[model samples]
Target: MSVEETMNYVLKIPWHDIERNLISRVQLKKIIKLRIILDKREINYPIYFYVGEKRDHVMIPYVFCSCKNFTIRVMSKKKKPSCKHLIMLRLALDKSMYREIYIDDLTLLKKIINEIIRIGLSPTLRKLLYISRNRRYERGRTDGA
Candidate 1:
């Protein structure tokens, strides 16, 4: 299969079910299996699989997560998106968003940040951009940030 096709297949594999049923039941075994699959495909870096809102979601390093992991990481880095963690998070979040999860508009800003990170932009530039944009919404922001 083409790379794109393979990726689609992998992403569609009912991660939520696996997380809920399989993960806790056989944590080590499932992780080993997942590691083998990722390794065979040469997918480096950590890929977090978890259940969110009863749906399975994968949090790659640079991807955004509704679970707040990405936001926490970015905020900890002072809005910087330089780390590999951020990059993977972006990739994972983009994929998830494309799957039609009804994400709130409040998370749109973080999505933009994820895109910027994916494009190889410098972290300093990203931080500056985030600050500028954040100011625009500061007055009436209800995003619970």
Candidate 2:
């Protein structure tokens, strides 16, 4: 088996154990520096943001992360199931290690939307998509006149 495949096989094992013992020294160091921000404005369910050095990554606990590492390695390559930010988030949430901070819903939504657009979509794609949306809205307004 190749190195990538071997690592993939190794990481497919139970995450907690691997995360605790096998996570790289660099990742371990980064784990402590990462921040988990919990937005509990909605009592029914809360939103989590993994605040990284360069950007904030939105995640739903074990489900997702908006980082390139998660998108490239975990999702596309399948070489690893979770990124360092994700592991830090899971640990913080389960252990209640995260500090609660209040950010109004509107501000939080703005941050989420901006971050997602910045990282989730390429510039050309974003321009094309938003331009099309504006054109559609203009057409609808004209049609109603």
Local distance difference test scores for all models? 0.36, 0.52
Worst 10 residues of 2 by lDDT: 28-37
Residue-wise C-alpha lDDT for candidate 2, range 1-145, written one tens digit per residue:
3345434543444555645542442243322211223574344344555444456566555656678887788778877756766666656654465533333345545555475557752333234334655878899999998
| Candidate 1 backbone clash number | 14
Instruction: Give candidate 1's error at residue 117 in angstroms.
Output: 16
The backbone clash count of each candidate, in order, is 14, 0
Off by over 4 Å in 2: 1-41, 116-145
* Model 2: lDDT of residue 66: 74
> TM-score, each model?
0.19, 0.50
